[model samples]
Target: MSELPHNWVKTPLTNIASVEMGQSPDSRFYNLNGDGLPFFQGKAEFQTVYPEIRKWCSEPTKVVERGDILLSIRAPVGPTNIAPEKSCIGRGLAGIRSETGISQAYLYYFFKNIEPWLSEQGTGSTFAAVSGQFIREINCPVAPTSEQARIVAKLEELLSELDAGVAELKAAQIKLTQYRQSLLKAAVEGSLTADWRTKHKPAETGAQLLERILQERRARWEAKQLAKFADQGKAPPKDWQKKYPEPLEPDTTDLPELPHGWVWASVDQLSESVRNGLSKTPNTDQRGFPIFKINAVRPMIVNFLAIKHIEIDKSEASDCWVEVGDVLATRYNGSVDLLGVFAMVKDVPVRTLYPDKIIRMKPVTGAGLGKWMEVCGNVGLSRKHLVARVKTTAGQTGISGEDLKKTPIPLPSVEEQKYALAILEDRLQSILELELPLEMAFKQSTAQRQNILRAAFSGQLVLQNPDDEPASILLERIRAERAAKLELKKPSSRKAKVSV
Candidate 1:
């Protein structure tokens, strides 16, 4: 689509290369014994520049020679790799070899530049696939053989430098993740607020706070019992405690020590309740009650933009409705890292109900405590514990409500927690500022690589050499060579008469 050199010309790919679609051999002929030839089915065998040999075929069907460019034609559609050795190729791949006056490397880069277009051309009901004709018909900019060599050399030099920069940015990203984890570890371990604690004493110890929470819980349960009896217009049960048992205290054997005025507690002791959300699928009506799925639970906060609406009546779904400051966690995911990932609700645009894949918790102490718990659930020590408890089945990892409730949490005095949280927020914000730019640069490097390829293919990457032969002359030579080859393959008139 861009301007090209005066000596360059545009030509169909078939003019310079032979395209061949591969046919898969019978599965009975497939083997891993290194018997006949290495077999490549598709992208699964593809590496950076060449296909990695995994399985071998005892009875080979279609084959590609060494240095031939192999293209995946199914689903992914456009990744190209050079054949390192003669190999059997399956139906999911096609091979291209230079006919004359073309470099295999130049063709590889040309295909690389138009990968997006090739992917768009793919069509299939079950999975996207392209035919051999598609490859043959695709137009490519042709450069003189000498100019192509120069362009490829310059492109590789520039791309290698860009790739190195991207690698550095990725390394920095990994370090940033490690740093954030360290910051959370420090917050929960009491080391972050050790200096602050020395300057300002806590108003109340963690043990005293827990005692007050227990008393409040007992009183609230008793009040609920009285209200229920009043509503029924019946005498109170003589032994209502049997029906509504008090919550059990968690065992803290072998648990790690906490700072002075701090204690170890379970999620159940800290939260008013931990429960899973509605199990039914939501209706498509956008005006209906909004529902949050596992995807809505992002790091630190819930994402309300991608929410779906349920058709259930507002009054009927009230029990599963969530409010601000409630901590939400993914109850199950195909990835273990995503399982039990937590987020706290901030602002709601509409009344929202969480889906079954998410579990919601309301802290008994305060919203600040809920926020702290959400952070703890995602990082270091506590995260390792949670991951260890995850049960996996059929590729999905899950943690039950009871298991979540039993998660051990480090508790500091309310004042110290507030202090530590402020520090953690400031440090994490600094890390984010650093992270965002690195991520943007990584994206830019990818775009830069694509630009280099585009320029190289359009004959803009290297200057045209007037002394070099023009592409028009090279193409005429290739056409003449192909015509001679076709003449050689044609059957003689005498041989045809003898056969008759």
Candidate 2:
């Protein structure tokens, strides 16, 4: 603790405020019928005041008045909020009530400064918990009633400005994310690079490219089929001819017109092979086969640094192995919104995938190149398709393998697809670089404002008056009142317990 200047005083946190622990009512008896009072849990107090809570209790004894500060003590600790009204809270929260000498707002901000330390002191095997005793011992700075009011006023004014700037930065980030999605949607539909295409002569339509790729893949399969037949010196099966597939037809329902030399088709038509990843437990070897989970496959690029590895069985290596350029799609997940998420592998030290969860599709031909496929997967059209086909349950939702096979994709000319992807990457990167400094400015502004509040509340912000009553006199009066109360509560003598 630093030495106080003039009339400034320092005190323990418990000396200045009252602390109360929370308890949960029987949750089985909880109802949304609105007959009882609102109850808050740690999660509900993170930032927003949960106006309508799913849990409630009839016990009026647990009710807390408005202006009381609530802090969570479990799972996610340090989430703080002011009680909105007469409300009850769960065991996860500890309520702090301010005395006349302290401002609620001042204490709230002060708690924010100490929350990290409290979290560090939390102890538990399953989940961290901040005991009530630990909370009571936490220390903070306190000033006179008038000084508390001044600090609260100055903090509110400054915090409002910081909050406004943070809100704007967050909104800008959201808009940027939306714009990126829109750009991808437009690119795959040919609108983003259509101007360039209109000026150039048509070499081939997208349908023609798909047809050409189909022919190339069929020829490769047929050659392999014949080679096997010749090696056996036996007649090929009659149904084998029927088993051969026909050329894929363009799906006109795929919205937005395709550019010349581009086409639309079900994702199944482009892939010769498709299956889920491996399910075996992965080995933690530093240099081994690389395996990806659903999280590894993000929007456009696969994050290779997060790969896990497993000791490969020879058969698994021969059949289900992943290679560079293979596209993987998440099939089963609780988050239905992430059902159709796709990513292409760029480098692989080892072949890996979990069985029955992620679908691995190796394109028959080169039409599904890395750069173009990334744009196609994240494009707006694909997202709409994913939303429609994904399976949704009350608590969870996700896409299935069959749904993934039917995902509608726009085929772009190999040359134009490359160019469009390059432009999008450069433009998006530049926008992010331009916004980085604005983000920094917002952080610095808040820090400077907090310093102002600290100074004001500590009496350094405003000059003191020599004629005014000193804080020492106020302390004496408080001590006198406490002593008088203790004198009246002197306990009657009872038989003291001796060693058993």
Candidate 3:
């Protein structure tokens, strides 16, 4: 509505077009093969040109003819496409018919630029709705007919190239992600860094060290149990203590042959303590204590900005507050792929995770280190074992502490464990450094596409033609035709006053 270029004008969409909102045909009328009329539903891609069509309805209600632009008005908005064939659309869409006043291509590009503004004006609580009146009221920038065609041609030229680059970047990212997983699988299977380990022979073996740690952990647990009994002034349940296995050995049949002297043992045998986070009311205010949840646990680095807020009581403050070297494991998820994904809390300086979704484990014996244990736990050997134990259902998948306690792990000697961890860290850190630039490159490609769109819509992309016919003449013709149609729609004066 404000100032424009030399030949440009501002106008309300209502003056330039007729709007038709789409409605869904009754489900009972839908047929698979009866006189095929293609049905259009709003999707992320261009709606009309796509090869796949899922729904069809015989009883027509909201019809869209060829060349009309169809825009999604609910759920996800702003996806607009020109219809290529006669079709019925669902309640989720709206069709715009240019009243011959504006070029179809010109209106398409105009909507692309102003879609964000239109979305802002949309009113609804759960899902946004853009009514016919809402679309008509939207303001648009106008140019001469010939100038609009020139702009469209220029935009198509640059946008096509940007789209190609984005597709290539996406493919590269997928390959890089696959490579990372392959690298981890190789490391766990004794394929990566095997030559280095073979060159050095330790006098002590991993199996012997694992067995000694299990014994030491059992002794500590027994001592703690005896102390609890004395404090309560009562006798402990001897049968209850005897029923559970104290230092459960790993099932060797589940794994391939390991490097010599590497022993398999259950995860619980080496644990000093296994605990979950505290559940408390969270404060949404940014200034309050920062808390973390299942989503904050990234693959390599912790995403600090993903933190939430939680208000905790002073009495229970000491119980769930996170310290460095605590391992966070997800106990519940819909997919087994995410069931037991673990994140190590290293050098954390904030209060986090006053919730039960994240399970924390600490080593009971001094024989094992946290970093080495984290690497072993995350590698393919442990992850596969954990996933196999998930209880499956219709829509639910879960893993419990008892299931975690039974996970078989290949344990190495303390000295070898330190060396193995160092090697793994060196390789993973190098991969992370390589990954960052690729991620940035992919992001930059998308930003460039948006920039091209911005330039094309702003009249800066193409030259304006002075000799071509102006849009003002076309508008006058469109207006006259519409007035004639409206006159035809008018009832005779004799019948105008009658009520139903």
Candidate 4:
């Protein structure tokens, strides 16, 4: 921070700009009809360079002219945007207008360079924010007027190219993601294994497998019921088996016809138990049993590290404990990307309990339906079903447990399920390998962007013009003008008081 070029001087932001902190008006004045001017609040309204207009304010309290630099001063601090037009800013933002000699483009890029610092400066018990005085006191190195223009021009040329490369990398990532989903879609729909089905026949057709699974499911329930009764020293009552509830059948209305030897089965039939996890908020003490946070369940990946330890009764922990081969569906999430997303527990690295935000489906053993069901729920029929069952509460999207249990999944016999899953894993792994370099390139480009900005600000981006006046001289002139203006506004008696 201390190494400055001979002609450059570090000046407080307020000395080179006017920082106007925003004040929100009454809620009654806000409208979605675009009544007066664009109402921008905080991070939500921001895009890469400009902001998206969502709300407008009729009786504007704080306004910023077009092209003013907008800075977020709340919870998520330090993202910057340029005002597209004359706008009303909320309390979450502060608008900055450059001084007469400084370039607005220069100031905008400077803010980008110091975003991490701005975030660190924010302080609050509930939500972090920076005071107007804090922003005013920030020190930045200003270049001479002509040199600033040169630096900005060079930066635009270089960064625009950088942005284009980043865009292509991002597009490749998206296409790869889409391709991977299509492969999974094909796998579950029986198309991926169509060739294998042609060459060989399965020992058990999907219909016969489902029938046998139901019989086994009932027998297991009956045995468990009998054991519980004996443990309580009570004899089994007559017609006890009649009390058992049957799994819901798949509704094939308007559903695509399955390939030969395949049938539709409800998730209810595939799972021995489908239930929500523990609802209690976990403690940070890292004691007792570990429970999963919502992040532990990603699409087909479980990150055991994303868990909290809680002191709960052993029985409660046992009930929510996730086991290997168990399929998990997100019950709800704040992001649309994660809602109704599914993952299977390939391995339980730790004895982890799950939260109410997750739904656990313990796949019926002896059938190789675990991986098949996991792939099924993530795409195809599950997606269509999810659209209808999605509900919003407290700004979160979620699906009900009852609806999840009835989700239809195309069933191939156990052998074919394994066959399809093997092909899927192999193909998905190839896609993942191909995606690795793109991710690394993405990170490298981001670092390169920061590097370019650093070079631009530190008297390295462009050649300095010796004819240009020093930034220090400009600051002095600004100071003198401000002093003269303040003196002019003072009372006549203050002049005599100063002379005395």
Candidate 5:
């Protein structure tokens, strides 16, 4: 550690603080009914200074007093929050208190400086965690009380400004997202092609195109049935076409009017099939067929790297295998944000199947159908439709295959669909390019925050006043006071023998 400005003391936390590790109370004491005190388990709702209280404890155990530093100690280790009031903390956290001559704010800032190092040092098998002994052994640079206060005051001033800048950048990114979604909505509704429509006319109107596709859809089904009948060496059944299930038509009651060459269509009318994938729990082994986790499907982005290898053969999971141009939709999720998200299968380098929590929609060949479906599913109205149908059966927010098949979307003639998608892609690519620098700036600002903390602790941020007492003298007084306190707690020899 760099030398502190003339009067600071660098010492292990044992000298200037006490560590109180938390322990969970009985399950019966845990309640959401606002019983006794707010309960904090891990880092679920942790924020800048304090954790937002949700669950409460009827009977408190392992409590932290107000202003104590609350440290997360399990799974994700080394983050800290402060206690706003006396509250119960579970095994995931430990409370720290500053001793005499040290500011609690200074201690909190010191912890913030060392977070990166602490994260690396945490150890465990199932979940990485830090022991109380590890926390106590960490060295903290202590500034004299007055200077500590000065440093904290300056940091808060500078950091508040930095935080504001970061917040603005985040808001900008959100605006980009909204703009992207709006572009897709406009493209599908033919707003983007309004000028193009005045110049170029489609050979087939949207209604006529829909009629042609429906005829093709039925013809394929009839051919499959005919082949089956021929294999049986018997004549085809009379009126076999009557047995074909008609594709679902969209309900246009509440839908808005489409452009002259466009019409509303159900996903079922546009797609050949809507089906769910395979389900096998405890199937991550990095061998056999690759299976996509729900995370692999984000809005217009599918990452094959976020996949697991399940111990199932390609043959056994044949029906679940995804081909190129297929659309994957998140069938169920805990977060509603992911409910209607869709991504197209660009390439299957290795054959893969999706989980049951994902629904696959294979569009009728030709007409840029797969990409159009992916775009339509992620549009604003479709998102609202999917969110409205979400059912929470046993703690999951999700949609059914039937829901995907019945969702309404605008359909344009094949020529117009291709043209709109090309324009939308060009605009969206520009937005993606702009986001690159914004994402990097967010990361850089976070590093700058750490730099500010480093400067403050190194005594480069605030000046030292020679009139202030040196930390060594303050430490000696604190030590003496602790020794006196320890002495008073000891039993005299005569009393000890009597008790024994």
Candidate 6:
């Protein structure tokens, strides 16, 4: 502890405030129809600075009056907010009220300062929680009444300015996200490479490119069939054509218009093969083969660190192994925001498999096209289509493999894609550079708020006034008043004997 200014004193919380632990009411008495007192269970119901009333209790067990500080004591411990109205608090919360000499606002700020320490002292087997004793035992630096008032006022003024800065930083982050989406939207719409198209016309249109991809696919399939025949020690069958069915072209009547050389194609038409991965649970052994889960599929890049290990047979491993340039997508997630999210695999150090919730797409046109497809998937037009196709059950959402295969993609000439990607990369890089400083500013503002609170409680935020009463004298007066109140509540000895 740092040395305090003259007349300032260190005081335990129990000396200056009353702490009340909450008891939950019976579940049968709970209702959402506003039949009784507003109930708060924990921090899950907390808004920016208040608890949002989601449920009510007909018979409230532990009640807190308006102006009392409500503190969460379970799991995420020590976030403090004021009770706006009289309400019932459940087992996960505690109510605190300041004594006569201490300002309620001053106590709130003091609790805010000690929040981190309170969180550290929390204990539990599954979820950490603080006991009622923890709240009573925490010490605070006390100043004279007049000084505490001045300190709170000054601290609020400083924090309000800091909050404004943080809000602006968050607004910038939203703008950055919007700007990236706009860049991708333009790239897919052919507006980004409008000038480049005039300088270098495509040698072949998208329709012709599709023809070449189909031809390549057929050639590869034929070669595989012949190799299988050789492995079986037999000649190629004469009627093999009757058994093999060619890939089907998707319906294009409802598709949107594209640029002169661009065409609309489904993911199935552009990719060599699109397959979902294994559904088996992974083992805990670190030496097992690494497999990518839904979390590994981030925007534009796969997070290798998020991969889990699995023990698999050699045949299953061979079928699921992912190659560099394979585009992976999340097939299922509880959040709609994560469904249909794409990530491109840039490199694989060893054999890697992906989980059933992740689909791997190997594009015949190479990694460059795969990257372009990933960007297209994130833009508003494609995102709307993908999200519309998603089916939801309970809290989880999923898109079937067939629905994903039918996702519309705007096909640009390979050259134009390369050019547009180059421009988009440069612009996106600049936007990211701007975001770094804003992120840093947010972190710094949080630290500065903590610094302001540190100064306020340490008798340094405002100048000490010698004319004001010292905190020690104020504490003695409060103790004397409390003692007198307790004495008044005691039973009279003469009356008790006569009644018996």
Candidate 6 displacement at residue 372 in angstroms: 1.0
Give residue 56's error in model 6 in angstroms. 4.2
Best by lDDT: 4
Question: lDDT tens string, model 3, 339-399?
Answer: 6776667766565654676677666553235565566666677887778788856666767
Candidate 2 global TM-score: 0.79
Q: List the candidate numbers ranked by lDDT, top first.
A: 4, 5, 6, 1, 3, 2
Q: How would you encode candidate 4's per-residue C-alpha lDDT over 1-500 as one tens digit per residue?
A: 43766788888999999998999989999999989999998889899999999999999999999999999999788999999999999999999999778899999999998887788888899999999999999998899888888989999999999999999998999999999999998988888999999998889999999888888888888898999999999999999999988898778897899999989999888788889988887887898789888888888888899988878888777778888888888898887678777788888788899888899998776325777778888889866787678998777789988889889989888888888888887888999899999989988998999888888889888987788899889888888888898999988883455654
Candidate 5 lDDT over 1-500, as tens digits, reads 47778798788898888888999999999988888999998877689889999999989878889999998888788899999899999999999999878899999988888899888987887879988888898888888888989999999999999999999999999999889878988887789999989998889988888888778777877888899999999898788789998877776787888889888888888777788888785256787778898898998888888898777665868788888889889998878888868888988887778888899887876436889888888885666677788888887778887877888878888888889889988999999999999999999999999999999999999888999988888889889999999999998768544654
Against the true structure, whose TM-score is highest? 4
Off by over 4 Å in 3: 1-3, 16-106, 114-132, 230-254, 279-283, 286-289, 333-339, 363-381, 385-408, 414-416, 488-500
Model 5 gets an lDDT of 0.86
Per-residue C-alpha lDDT of model 2 across residues 145-245, encoded as one tens digit per residue: 66666667767787787778888878887788787777777777777887878777556666777777677767777877888899999778877756676
Residue 489 CA displacement from its true place in model 5, Å: 4.6
lDDT of each: 0.85, 0.69, 0.69, 0.88, 0.86, 0.85
Q: Which ten residues in a row have the lowest lDDT in candidate 3?
A: 43-52
Q: Estimate each model's TM-score.
A: 0.83, 0.79, 0.79, 0.95, 0.88, 0.86
Query: With candidate 5 superimposed using the best TM-score fit, by how many Å does residue 289's alpha carbon deviate from the native?
Result: 2.7
Better of 3 and 4 by lDDT: 4
**On residues 321-384, what C-alpha lDDT tens digit does candidate 1 reach at each position?**
8888898989998778788888888777877899988999888766888888988888756677
Q: Which of 2 and 4 is ahead in lDDT?
A: 4
